[model samples]
Target: MSNARLPSFRFLIGFEAAARLGSYSRAAEELCISQSAVSHQIAQLEEQVGQPLFRRKGRGVELTVSGRLLLDSVGKSLDQIRSGLSRIETYMDDSLVTLVCPAPVVKGWLQPRVDRLLQEHPALCPIISIDETARYIDEMDVDIAITREPLKQRGVLEVPLLDDELVAVVRPDSDGQPAGMLCLETDLTSDRIGPFIREHFGNLRRLAIYDDPRLLLDAALRGHGVALLSRLLADEALRSGQLRHLAAYPSLPLGTLWISRTEGEPRLPLVRQVFDSLLAYSKG
Candidate 1:
């Protein structure tokens, strides 16, 4: 098909739906079509897009990098149209949604949820706040936030998501040796390294803290201080032996992440949609 005629919004919509939801059956249900129809539409769209959009994994699916890029490209136009219609119906208000999260959590946890968000609520545009500078965080003005501390906020409503946990970590290469002052990429005291310090050494010594976990993992490999980190964040380090659990200590209570939204504002359907998606996303 020619580029001009290739948009095939129906096909693109179906494919995007299938790719993001990870199932042709669900996509079909959402589109009010048969599963076979959903598959044929996606297959045709894939041929036009000139690449495979999804890889079958047993009963579910996962998108390829190209699939992700296509969704990104076409998502905004679709969202705009959807939001415009929503506004015309005077059924909901416009919205801007934002989230705040630590870098590692952004990388491991939230990244996987974006696609599902697109599939579930195509009209809600989102911006993610990842790099949390002390000054910037204080000045942040967002509609929704995912924060570690559920401290009092002026206008935000906070709903706790899950309990964050800290696990021991080290470099994949080095033998777990020496084991004194635990080395971390950055300010360990703030990242929950204090408990390990009190437990392991009896006296807390805040020595040799790097701002990067790569360096801390290096030191841990070289038999430095035990690296305390989130199990989700340190999975690769644990798997490769770059980080190792020094003791079977009870997982550290890093704190609970909350879904914070501004109070008093009407719940935009898109926002409520994403909120529901996230809640279900949490269960999964």
Candidate 2:
């Protein structure tokens, strides 16, 4: 139980490398030092242990009984140290929360309330990224995800965030006659919305087509044309009188938006808090 006579880290590192590689020169090359340094360190380790750890072989070196025993303990220690460092790096900034959201959700929903969310939780550091395809939520390291579809996987908890409907939105100040139609590509691909638009509004000129509904919302706000977009996305604008539901077209039923996080015990309380806050915000 004497802590005073422990071998130095440098000696242990040199010893482990030399014993594993069976060559002081190879250990030195791996350690980015000269063979003399490796030899010196190992010699010091041997002096401290009061036993010779290596034996001369034909061209390389071989581990003696003591050397092999030390290497086993030293290698395990190094592995644990490396794993500890990696775990520590993740906690260096606990306030940092990563979120992956679809572009439409980010622009129309999250972007508008970001200022208020921070005001409520000033210490929170949010890193929000757009993942329209929802790839990062399943494949990458993220704290929260908002997607059009729910993720049903082990250890993942997904809940409905908002129930939305597809509607044609136009600027409030618009005269009865609009310029053209602005459409989301996905809406046009939907079985219901796609065929409905073609049958009813086919006579109207198509001004612009966009893959992202955020873009369609923007174009509608700018008076470019009538935008076929989700009501959830246009809610802020509609409430502010910047945009209005085009009364001529019936609102088509869209689906529920989902908010998801890993199930069971949470790593960070802030992630759970933020997730709950978002759900509450959506309901409000």
Candidate 3:
């Protein structure tokens, strides 16, 4: 706001057009205004800036040193403003809700309950973002977010979504002849689960290691090995009998998963509706 005394946006636009086109008549034609109007705007802007912004060069105009410097700053500022305006258009769309979370939650949790969500709110259009990390809920424009750690920012409300308990599982038909072990990479490095696994199942060869729990789930389903992953991620598979708890090891407590939203009143009712529905689903 320090630029409070700066010339009006209208004058800046006119000045930018004239400077870019290098001709007052061409700028006027493009702006659908009289050539004299462009001249007047330039004169007003230069007066406010305390310098001449342009000089005559044959039939066209060329920018002065001051004009070039102003153009560089004004051009970038205009672009940033235009980009914000464009984002506003998307933000105002009632059908769209931006949801951010890790990929495992999307596969094991949200995907299973999405159909019910749509049935409850047919008009909702979810923009699911699993690939991008949303470190700041307020700054990312995320209506709802699922995170491994709770956000403690002033304007963010974080609630427990799931307990990240590590469980060893395998295909139901393995018949005690399962392949090597498949484990989430994080579990292998964690203080609690890593030592437990190494102490109990040190003889079992590792078939594969994955950074994502969903991948470990798939590998277990295909009978690749006795895959170790979050119990939450394997919830659906276990419930459906596609997989079962490995009898050799007990489930270990890891961490908690959190769901968060921007605290206070929301811009739209649809955001609150989605958040409430997701919260209920997680609890159920």
In terms of lDDT, the best-performing candidate is 3
How do the residues 94-170 of candidate 3 rate in per-residue lDDT, one tens digit apiece?
Answer: 88888888787788778888889999989999988885465466633688888888778788888888877778888
CA lDDT of each prediction against the hidden true structure: 0.64, 0.83, 0.84
lDDT of 1 by residue, 6-118 (tens): 65778988887887689999999999999999999888888877888888889988888888888887777788989868555543335455556676766546776788788
Highest TM-score, which number? 3
Q: Is candidate 1 or candidate 3 better by lDDT?
A: 3
Candidate 3 lowest-lDDT run of ten? 131-140
Off by over 4 Å in 2: 1-92, 132-140
Q: How close is candidate 2 to the true structure, as a TM-score?
A: 0.66
Task: Output the worst ten-in-a-row residue range by lDDT, candidate 1.
Answer: 133-142
lDDT of 2 at 221: 88
Off by over 4 Å in 3: 1-8, 11-72, 131-140, 155-157, 262-265
Question: Clashes in candidate 3: how many?
Answer: 0
| Best-to-worst lDDT order | 3, 2, 1
- Checking candidate 3 for backbone clashes, the offending pairs are none
Higher-ranked by TM-score: 1 or 3: 3
